[model samples]
Target: MIDRVWTTNEKFKKRSEQNIVARSSLPWNHSCGSKSFAATMSTKAEIPHFVDFFKESHWSKKKDDWLDHKCMEKHVELENLRTMCSQPDAIPMSQEEMSISVLGKKSGYLRGYGVGRKPSNTNTTSRENDGEMIILREELSSLKELNETQQNQLVRQQQQLEAQNEQIAIQQRTLEKFQAALLRCRLLSSDQCGDDSLEGC
Candidate 1:
């Protein structure tokens, strides 16, 4: 059974290799490459049209050189990509390392977006003003409470003064009544002494 399985695996590998070669030799692949070159040349030829549309002298030898330089750079990038794909294990990166690298890139982006800058003086001053406003509000609330208490005390004192004044008025009325009674008693005694002197005569 193991020998049969091994033969089957070899057959599958050979079939895959044949398929790859057949695909590479197809006329369509060559045609596609030729089409791509034609498209690139056409695009290059259209540069002058773009310059005319924009009303600019954008088509120059220097610009063409720059474009060629960009193409060479792109070719180098593609070659590097091919090399890396051919030997993926040559510089194997673990999942942890990939995550760390991604996190580092994200942190760098955030810093560039202004996360790394110190707070401005205006922000500091605004914070200080906020704190001062809170303190002032608390002081005002306390002052309101103290004023309420003082008002209540003044009302009580006013009530007490009114009560004392009423009591003094009542006492004055009682003293006047006592003085009138004493004067009437003295007048009655004098009349009785005059009657006794006439009887002795």
Candidate 2:
């Protein structure tokens, strides 16, 4: 009788150990598996829709449209310039010569009547005009370089903004999923507490 009792006790202990192991390996609650499945399906369904919406969205198309318009305008300007340069009487001046002719010219009376001025004064004025032209050219070149740098910076900033927006959206989705999971967990625990039974779960 003692040996039989010992054997039965050992069998009970083994069965209890196996049950514990199985329970540990299983999901925390029966609804957990279903909830996960639902979450996965929800995410999968949303992803394709989100991608399609993003692809077809106005913001996505706006950049491309703006770029196309700019390119077209540039092409038209270049064509106009070429046509102008191809004319018979058109003098194709170098950029430097053009700048000097445009910026070096005096305005008002100085341009109209230069003969009345003294020779020394005329020489000084000419030197002053040349210095102003050089300064203007340098300023124009620096401004052009600054404009290019600003354009590059704008492009980089736009890219960074897009990347950050995408990241924020992903984080928002993840946070929503986590909130839903927490809510479900709380509901499950509440039900378990009220019932005080594992059978319903």
Q: Which stretches of candidate 1 lie over 4 Å from their true place?
A: 1-128
Flag regions of model 2 displaced more than 4 Å. Answer: 1-131, 197-201
- Residue 64 local lDDT, model 1: 51
Local lDDT at 110 for model 1: 22
lDDT of 1 by residue, 1-201 (tens): 856665778887688779789677632222122233324334443422111211121123444532234334433443454455357233322222222333234453221111232323543464557767567657766776887899999999999999999999999889888888988889999999999999999
lDDT of 2 by residue, 72-172 (tens): 44334434554664564453433223223322444421211121322234345645688675776677667768878999999999999999999999999
TM-score of each: 0.35, 0.35
lDDT of all the models against the reference? 0.47, 0.49
In candidate 1, which residue pairs get closer than 3 Å at backbone N, Cα or C atoms, i.e. clash? none
